[model samples]
Target: MSTDVEINLLDNRWDASVASGMSESELLLYRSNVLGSDKRVTNYGGGNTSAKVLEIDPLTGEATEVLWVKGSGGDIGSIKMDGFATLYMDKLQALKSLYRGVEFEDEMVGYLPHCTFKLNPRAASIDTPLHAYVPRKHVDHVHADAIIAIAASKNSKDLTQEIFGDKIGWLPWKKPGYELGLWLDKFCRENPDADGVVLESHGLFTWADDAKACYDMTINVINQATEWLAQKSEGVAVFGGAKHESLDVDARRAVAASLMPAIRGFVGGNQHMVGHFNDSDAVLEFVNSQNMEPLAALGTSCPDHFLRTKIRPLVVDFDPAKGNLDEVMEGLPAQIATYRDDYAAYYERCKHDNSPALRDPNAVVYLVPGVGMITFAKDKATARIGGEFYVNAINVMRGASAVSEYVGLPEQEAFDIEYWLLEEAKLQRMPKPKSLAGRVALVTGGAGGIGTATAIKYLSEGACVMLVDINADGLATTVEALAAQFGGDVVRSVEMNVTDEGAVAAAMAETSVEFGGLDILVSNAGIASSAPVEETSLALWSKNLDILSTGYFLVSREAFKLMRVQDMGGAIVFVASKNGLAASPNASAYCTAKASEIHLARCLALEGAEGGIRVNVVNPDAVLRGSKIWEGEWLDQRAGTYGTDKEGLEEMYRQRSMLKRSVLPEDIAEAAFFLASDLSAKSTGNIINVDAGNKEAFTR
Candidate 1:
């Protein structure tokens, strides 16, 4: 092996003091978490780790050896003690006696539950048998990119020998199941001195009689392979050298922002898809390379990679040298259509008699030359994770193609893995998606009570939200709180003044790039001013009109432009006020501005009807609690006007309502949720009064 390459290698993170105190099972969890923390070791949900421990059998009152392994669909990086499935070692070994042949191996999964120890409810993954029959106290199966680079080469066996000598063994490709598990046991029996093996077009498996030893061996083996590949491939041109120069960072992002929404529209024919954009150095290098199309066409080599990213990505016909984004936009629909047809053809050519009915044929990953990669999926995190996996594949291809011919998994093999009956069964067990699972929303004035409440409601129902506010500090606090509740992936914030035309347009672009596109806009940014007609200053009147009427128009106009590009109908909910309809004695400017907001919704409804866009109004009255406006001078002014103090103002408003109930931010949120959801799909240009029975604001 060459020694010229000097690169950052994987660090051995096992602290002796820490490991000395942990129990055997806790050590397994600790080892798995550390390995999973770095994508260089394994991609998310792409590996399994296990340890055999002695436990008292609940049924027989005797000490027995049990296997503790990661459960199905659990990510090692975030898994807890409950995430592991425990099974009796004797039963798992005895399963070999029941296995008839490779063809009937899938039936073995049905018996895993029967082997459960202590009635642990976690379902064992298909990889359980591979770990079980290894004949070692600890085992780790990880899809490391370095090992896969060697595994995916045309002469992978030769490369494996050149890198690790006799320390690690090799096995040919076999779809992971009971049969593959037996193959591993047989390999271990034959190669007694070997510490691990690399599976062709699969992943790496390492074992040790000690828990820490297994982790050390796993990390050491991967590091060795990575260093060797780097040395052998040093000074080699990546992806056959770049075919197109990379666009400047700003231009690349602009191109991605332009293409994402249109592509989202085409692929979202069945269900809405959130988008993720990646312009990292690796992604830029690959996308701007000469071999990008051919390598992408080969699809991913690992089953885990293809399972997240579809079989292959769709290569967009974009050239940064020409800078013809408009032309690219015009051709996106046709390009997307061709991709679907090709995917369908692949399914038809490789499918078996019992393959699951054809799934959504749309491509998950999209490659734009000279810009970056765009991925669309059912939700934001999935889309972003899919991009990360593709980047991993890019790394593998770069290393493999540099030293040896990079090879993809056979088309039939990839199809079998994707459409396997076992995989299909797992898919069927997933929970139904939430009502707004794939939708994205932007709430203006999101730092305030009503805006924050509306965002929380949308996020609860599975929508990605972009919170827009002018208060920098408040926006940051609100974003931090929401991110804590709903993860940072689904919540984003932008400080923007809705009245500025330029700010409104930039916010729209940011939303497109942030979450693919927009599906709902809750126009809730406003201020409350209480002054008699004589006392109201020109400045106060202009402020109300500027923020309430003109601001709403600017935001809606930009939203319409973006939604039109997506060609998917959207919802626009205007949070007007009950005072817009009921004339108050001391607040002409506030009432007139709000009335303008209500009328704007009516006009937008008339114009957006043909495009399937629905516009509606939610009129709220005396929302005193949890409202930023009510916390300021507006509270004192309103209390003075009604002859009540701050303490009694809420009760005064409650008694004035016909239903004698106080209005809160949550009430407005619920109303906004209805208008934005399918519950009000058929109703447009309508008003839902959430004032606890305000006759003056009634929309009859």
Candidate 2:
């Protein structure tokens, strides 16, 4: 194995000019970013980095050595200087004396805060002491997959010693605490030539006097381990079986569509939940391996991953040939019951007096043979995180299996970290989630102004959104933008002409499968038509009716069917227009179609009331600016009707409303959000005017 250090990134965009005169803290931030940018080094929030620096006390004017370590809940990839917690080394070292005879679960947590040099609100990482005790100027710690692949193997100590010789020290599995720090301090003192330490079933720790040296050391150590595994596993197929074959996407989706809802209901407790499907090649290979059941029974690759993916994932049998969705659904309750029973039993065996309340017995990742993986959480972002961590776990497990056998931390040790008070406190300190945290929403006409705005609003308020539009290109752009703001898993795109009954049905089925089930539907897709009744052709009239009126009915019918199947009450909001309630010249087709849409909402409201579904309408007027409906010939014709230009028509409408504010796509979106959320639980068959203040279109 070559130990040469090279920084040949595919995209080496880091500016040396910008980094030349950086402060010690800024250099630390840059180094951490470099480490975090590599997924092979660490997953999200899975590692910590620190630098020992001299800081003059503001009050005393005395220089003291301090450790600035990555704080709790901070992502190293984009972290700023404030993301680190400053801790006094003297105080931290003194803590060892105080915690000498103290139990790790009881006494170590309270002393962590006292070691803080500055009274910052951010809590220091639980591994802060480990960083402080290292006798080096710079320290870098990561749950690198290559290192863990070796550390988590059945013959970890032997494999590690053979790979790195005495260049690295080894510690048996120990939860991160004062004892682990003391052990590391002792190991480094004894093995003065060791450049790093590998924690069995945990992670890697590398240190040097300078930041680059430490980082290079990490890369070198990981590369050696990876090279050894590569040589050992040459021509050895990791996954092989007759059962492993190409998966049927449609059949898997059908199975997911049928089984996810039941799983959602069982795991959701009182709150609703959403599920995301992951069929990446890595996930599929792991799920399809003949040894999948045995491999999955092994715990998570590391203890840090326990909070995202539970100790072990739940595995369910699935066969596309049998197409026995009902059988799978029938067996889910018992399977989940057994999972819960096993979890509770594990807790009973491992619980300490200081252990926090047992978390809800829910599986984070689900593995199905011949199908893909499904991850469930209270919201989309968390579900994506769980899915991502499981993918990483599979890679690590595969590497370890290729060498020898994959073995994770023992149950008791994992429990110690999962129920650790320090980790639990981080979650407790987070702000309360948004009202629509676990809800799912579908917005049609999503490529247009109103649809895109409504999707953004729902996402901001913490709802997973499905953007449906007939324009494939436009829909892809919109979904990409929203996914950037919210996470990609929280926002998705579906292409369908809402007027086609078959397309609408398939879209609804896909949405249900994608997000477990639906809760809110925004029927906002429509186009504008401007002509006098004498000038309007049959084709134009029929086209407007098919999309504006009939399309709303088709989408609502399909959405309502899924809502009823889930037995979960949902909301539907129809985007009509001010012309629907009032008369408008030269817009006979558009006005007529919108009016029909309004009455159709009312009829559905009456029928949906029995099923606890709320249906309402929002009438917006003259929202010309981002709207494609008022562009091109339609803009000129509407302006000509008022004997002025388009700008003049906009000003006249803005001045006509009581509020004198221009109605926008976001304005209609706000009204739609209110109707879709629980704020309007008792509201149905209602028309909210989003036209600034159009008294002429007001409803009694």
Candidate 3:
């Protein structure tokens, strides 16, 4: 409830630097980072900042006032000097005269670019004009959660007035453009005493002659709102305990497993999709609250959120203990159809002549009682961002509900901003996303050399991967390394025996829940057993078949079932060995088991081809550098057979190949990637040899 700003941290970092020397632009960049680093002030790329500074015009070599504002697609948290787009202040100010009823989408957007100081200044932020119009050297804007909670309430104007007195002006939600900028300029001119402006249901804006003052003002205003809300809800508990208690963990997992595939299929469309279940304490509390339905349907907390979360979430009815998934499945299609129909109607009701084409009408967030929330998107990043936004939204709504009824922007108003060309153009300006951007992949024996390499390859191509292995220690180490490289959300680990049917099924279910659906399965789990047929024990032969052959079958069968449910074609790659095609002495058991794995892939290819599911195999040989299989007795045995030390054995195997090259795990990984990707769209039931030049193992 304290309305104090944390100015000490800034003082510590800036006091000495300020005394020495700091340019206006550098100070602005430093302040922008400070503001953006706080999630309470800005979430992701949701805010903009600027500083008006004197700069020498390149052509004239004379000092001129310029407005440097955060550029489009630039994250304030990590922005640099180049991150701000520079525009001539006089030229931008002169644009006010031309805004005589000129619509933002029509002539104003086209004119703003002409006022830039440079030929092609970094695409100026959509709110560039708002900053230019604010009569201050430094300006900071943020979608502060505390301010949002108050600004989005039913009586926001009164609440804002009560908290900030007449020192703050209130502007009704207006799509950011020329008109909005002009209106703000006129308002400030009239109400010179106001320190800032609150855009109803949008965000807050504060400005001052100094960067520190502007940042301090932002924190102070947000703190005031937070304290007011805290005082109002001191003793009142708005969200009562759940009327329907949460189901046990086991039952919840079962419910998620049963319901996720159908939901994934219904919303997948043609693009590969993934789902993430967020069961954090906040999410669970929100889902289980007595007023969950009404508060959730109220609408998104802000207009920008619409682009990511849609207008409202889809709320499904479920009694965790008594609900029948079959019944839920039977009604799901109709529910989705209705959701789409309603969205289409909303578009029809709000569409303007210049509005962009309607986007697909699918709910990005799903609220299920006793199971928490499920956020869906084409890729993991978007889904995770959407999930985080919703969690913030829930908190805002909860706080606002305790003070006053939560109110979002009007539907027509939201539509205007959602389809605004100025906003839509930002998305178009982005580079094309990766091919496997939103797909989920599962790899068995993911701690091993070939499996680890293949997982990294999939991650590099933008797929979220789940690494399954029975080696708990190795799995933990591998997952930690990969997560550090590709972000923790993009990589996950599951320890389970692929040969265990129950465990494999559970793992597949976990994958589906963690990431919406499985699109790629790499059956790379195997054990190397070298023994002559006569010397091989019944246990040794059965063990090889169970892991190398049967394990592949179990994992593939589970993946195929999920892919079939998703109805989206998937890819499966089996890491077999060159010995499968050409038998090796003292490796009878290993050869037979690998051969069984190859045939299993072929049979799967036939059955899966009709469903657009591709099944392929990669045959690799002597990948000893990183191979865990080459450790201990296996290393000594191979070296002895080659009549030299382990080091010499690697060279001996390399020279045996026609190419005289060492077969590395990365080499096999490359082939697996091609088969997993669309590069092999027309290919299935094929064996790609990763061996350098094994003529005997070549698939002819």
Pairs of residues at least 3 apart in sequence or in different chains that clash in candidate 2: none
As for lDDT, the candidate ahead, 2 or 3, is: 2
Tens digits of per-residue lDDT for model 1, 1-700:
1223457689998888878889989999998998899889999999899999999998889999999999999888888999999999999988888998988989999999999999999999999999999989999999999999999999999999989899899999999888899999999999989999999988899999999899999999999998898888887878888898889987887888889899999989889999999999889889988898999999899899999998899999998999989898888888989998999999999989999999999999999988999999999999999999999899889888988988999999999999999999998998999999999999998999999999999999999999999999999999999999999999999999988999888888888888899999999998999989999999999999999999999999999988999999999999999988888879999999999999999999999988889999999999877778887799999999999899999998899899999999999999999999999999899988899887877777
Give all candidates' CA lDDT scores: 0.92, 0.84, 0.84
RMSD of each: 1.6, 3.7, 3.4
| Model 3 global lDDT (CA atoms, 0 to 1) | 0.84
The digit string of per-residue lDDT tens for model 2 on 475-532 reads 9999989988887778888899988999998888788678988899999888888998
What is the lDDT for 283 in model 3?
Answer: 84
After superposing candidate 3, which stretches have Cα over 4 Å from the reference? 1-21, 102-106, 118-121, 237-241, 248-253
In terms of TM-score, which candidate is strongest? 1
TM-score of each: 0.98, 0.91, 0.93
